[model samples]
Target: MVKKMMQRILPRAFLGKPSLLRRSATASQSTLAQTVQENEPVLPKMPPFDYTPPPYTGPSAEEILSKRQQFLSPAVFHFFKNPLNLVDGKMQYLFDENGKRYLDAFGGIATVCCGHCHPKVVDAIVNQTKRLQHSTILYLNPAIADFAEALASKFPGDLKVVFFTNSGTEANELALLMARLYTGCQDVISIRNGYHGNAAGTMGATAQSSYKFNVVQLLMPSIHLTFISSFACVSKTGVHHAQNPDQYRGIFGSDGSKYARDVDDIITYGTSGRVAAFIGEAIQGVGGIMELAPGYLPSVYNTIRKAGGVCIADEVQSGFARTGSHFWGFEAHGVVPDIVTMAKGIGNGIPLGAVVTTPEIAKVLAHRSYFNTFGGNPVCTAAGHAVLQVIEQESLQQNAFTVGSYLKQRLTSLKDKYEIIGDVRGRGLMLGVELVTDRQLKTPAKVETLHLVDQIKDFLVDVMDYTLSKM
Candidate 1:
């Protein structure tokens, strides 16, 4: 049913074409080269309206880079060979120090859902900041309470209780604890290539080796007293990873049921049969915008519940109408998770996140004193409330759906044209185009992918220029 609905919404041509990848390698290479050369640089045209940025009086990018190296952790990295020293943003466009506007395609790593520095959101933050800034959860603040009510209204089912945190990591950490406390089990299941957080508990749930560090050993032994880290690695012991049921490149094509069977097998063999929770991103964000196969979640959710576990939807990157089709990504799956963890767009780039669950599950937190110092800060909540309003008033969700679908269709055309463009997948604005050398083997064309990304950057810059010239 879900597949049929998707077919109605998206072009039928966008569906799986398994044999396309099996085309002759020589013809593929020739077509790829011809397509790459023929594709001209196209820039996003600027809107035909009057707008100008305030003068930038800050230090130069070079100076900032020097200061960053000296003051910030080396772990902090920047994209591009020459990193963008972005100084200003308005809606969907970002401006560098010289006021050169560029379309923000990634949307601040998919955090700025309603656009950067949205007036309504900024006004709310400014007004709230002027009224009251700092107050802990101990005090009764209307901002937090109001925002909580507003956020809870967005979800279906009994996911009414809201717990605020400073980041997605904190939200996931809290959710993990709630699941364990409710189920009285320590084992948790997450999908390979899924990322939850960087904190000790969430770090364990995260399956990607790229994000995991040696620091897990230092934090796990002391912080997570209930779980042991000696199960080979922090992620391996208490947490189990099911194969990411990738549609384009998986053992089971688009049959989600086939991949979900692995989760059942993992529970029977990998764990002690009973578990606390099954946590996953509705659409894997940093893991290359991979969407779980259709019917995967419904099957897995039931499987986890039968194993005495709760289902957690990590919406840090996929929530808040970003997917276009649904207000929440999990809604597209036709299953409601026991717990929903959100960040990124929830605060519109502000450091805010939350875990929404049922009252019965929330009672576990009440069993012991739990607090987050700056979780529901008044200003942040006000901004969050404003973000919700902006999304509704501006009809941004509809915009995401329309624009994202059009973009995906165009990307699909590119995939059909160029063999290097192996796959283009995702929903709404949260989309990805995977590049591969040999489509048959599904080999990652790393160097070519980087080049294509550079070309995209150049094209966006050109579009910005074109828009400015017309203005």
Candidate 2:
């Protein structure tokens, strides 16, 4: 059980960290350990914590799975073959039902900004809930107002107006709606393989086929919503998918201008001359943590604006200091977007999202009786404000920069030792290691990587079993 518990904690290996090769454990996680023979590098020792969660008193994982299979949506899924029942969390670790600790490098899908159940965030939520839980936007609430000002302060240029939502899907949905209305254009463009959200507008904007359903697009309402009923089944908006500026496998080989030309062609050939918006992430987190080819954003932004389209930066995955070098991923590209949509890390695991844009663009919503019913819940806003304060107070942005650089440097060195490592890219903490069956051909070794990683994880189980017995 102890050995299995340790395998549950395998964290940095997936990110290609060299912590496996004998080093001090970071606060977050331990280095990978295998049954090393003589002359092999030793597995780093885990640091001691003066903490352990109380015994769990709940249904077992199998029982929960049985209930879920019986009652829950079939679309929902779990990670490993047997789901891990995580019950408690600290800054960089999670506790399973049996109180086994696992280093949480995943950060709850990059949502836990200050770590799980961060004290400050918890305090803020509790205190705010004690005071006031929910109030419609028609009423005044200091939490929402204060948080809006603080979040708006993080932007540049005329992106002062803020609108809050419950998730990234809502944020992106609102942003796209604003773009179409403000620009009076029907065509939208998004980068291929980028994921924005799952709502009607955003699902159409989301370019990945795997995440997209055929009928959802057709059922989505048209851009001219006021004229049409909310349930009007207008064909999906004309969303042109631009070629992904993938530096590693792209035909242009890191030449972003070449990819930018594709968007120009898309505008000329795919739609009317004018477009509603051009949306993309600086770092494609869902698309293998690939950074857009150099100079891509500036060139694309210029072309989109020339076509009278607004440029939107979808910072859902790469925002809030996840990308170490900049506070917002788009900033690293040196472009200030006309609209920016963000979530995942804004409230340190709270269900909070926001869209920031110029006052002119934001005013489009005024044309309609637009509002999120549960968007600016006081408890959520208070928690979000506390998250912003914790990020600054802890200097987590700088920590991400410094630590991410170090990890990147170490990960880069692994390419020399392993022939399968095809490419190592991304800035700061948002990094990816692509495996290839044939390095020269760059054939994706998805199965091979998964099989090999599973072996490593299983080997870790053995190592933990050995170590725990000794202890």
Candidate 3:
């Protein structure tokens, strides 16, 4: 309703799932394929899909850009110098204003688990919206209950209770609050180079400086207001970012136990050896798809539990079968998290997120009434349920495993061919290609990467190698 209302208020603003698009590339795109391996590697052919999106007749990209600059926040940005005015989506393909088609590989940052505007998901959303849209949690709604049960059933151990939110930020914030309440401690730990959200606690817990802003001084009313109105978006006050167990770039190398020791040292020396939670993404999506080193999560989870902390798995980008080999990303790490927060893929492309935890730990919320107006709205929940069904019915997880493995295998070969490709990491479709000028030094090839990006942009398809710091 809000997005629909916005459409009327600001014509040609945006509609449906947000699009990350760029203009079609020039013939120079051939450079990537030509820049292949020593064995003369051939790029994989994209699987053919039968459907075609309806013709697009929308405002031109220039018009949309003019309106956006005049009306939207200056901070809002998109890829490529000339951004794409995408108008329609069908399954894994997107259409620009000119009706030019492109295959979607990013999967809307891993949100389109069942694909964009999937028939099942759309049918569920439309059917549910036709009956009821919003009734808050005060009233009994089968959509919320049924979907919650189905989602919880997918988790291991006692993570059977679910709390809904409109975005990953809210889910993570709620998880932080629950952890603090459960452990009765203020100190929280997160992995370095991981992104949680942009809200207060989540932003603080997020380790990457790129995702944070200054003016977090809560007491500085004027600066804080100027920064984010009434919101405090910075300050790692009680948050401790543990050393990232990055195999390719971390100081500890691939010895995951050595990196886990850093968390133990933090607990022993920092705070009072008590922590509220330890939050980590099994595969660091925002951190250039860097996965936690093998044996890292198990050891860190044990140490955090010993410190009286709850282990929180932030699965915003890697959950809902995106990881291929596992339903949830943490499952790949061989540990059960006390609290699991997810979004992105939960409702396919809809704005939905959830925090699932054990029933015992969930009771802490009973101490105070907590409510979200649009957290589990019937339409979103219904779509979320449909997404789950589609994942099972279509067996997207197995498909991810099969396809992602092939893609990764090809990319690894490229690493051998090109010295610029310093690392190829990540699981399933959530993959990354890091570029370097020198293999031994692992020097980031920022300029070359940007040039390559400018060359292909989002017109890229069946990609295997290329990218610098992604900086």
Q: Write the per-residue lDDT of candidate 1 for residues 6-39, one digit (tens) a residue.
A: 2221222222332233224455545534433343
TM-scores for every predicted model? 0.88, 0.86, 0.84
Which regions in candidate 3 have their CA more than 4 angstroms from the true location? 1-49, 217-236, 458-471
After superposition on all C-alphas, the RMSD of every candidate to the true structure, in Å, is 6.6, 7.1, 10.7
What is each predicted model's overall lDDT from 0 to 1? 0.81, 0.78, 0.78
Show the lowest summed lDDT stretch of 10 residues, model 1.
1-10
Best to worst by lDDT, what's the order?
A: 1, 2, 3
**Candidate with more favorable, higher TM-score: 1 or 3:** 1
Clashes of each: 3, 0, 0
- Candidate that would win on TM-score: 1
Alpha carbon lDDT at 347, candidate 3: 93
Error of 1 at 161 (Å): 0.3
lDDT of 2 by residue, 1-471 (tens): 332332333333333533232322242233233312222424545456667788899999999999999999999888765568889887776788887666665687778879888889999999999989997988999999999999999999999999999999999988888887787776788999898888777888888888888764613344455675332222245687999999999889899999999999988877667787899989887788989988889999999998888999999889998887899999998999999998889988889999999999988999889978989889999998998998899999988888778767766776654456789999888888887756779989777566555545434433443443343
Expressed as tens digits, the lDDT of each residue in 251-287 for candidate 3 is 9788889999999998888767777789999998888
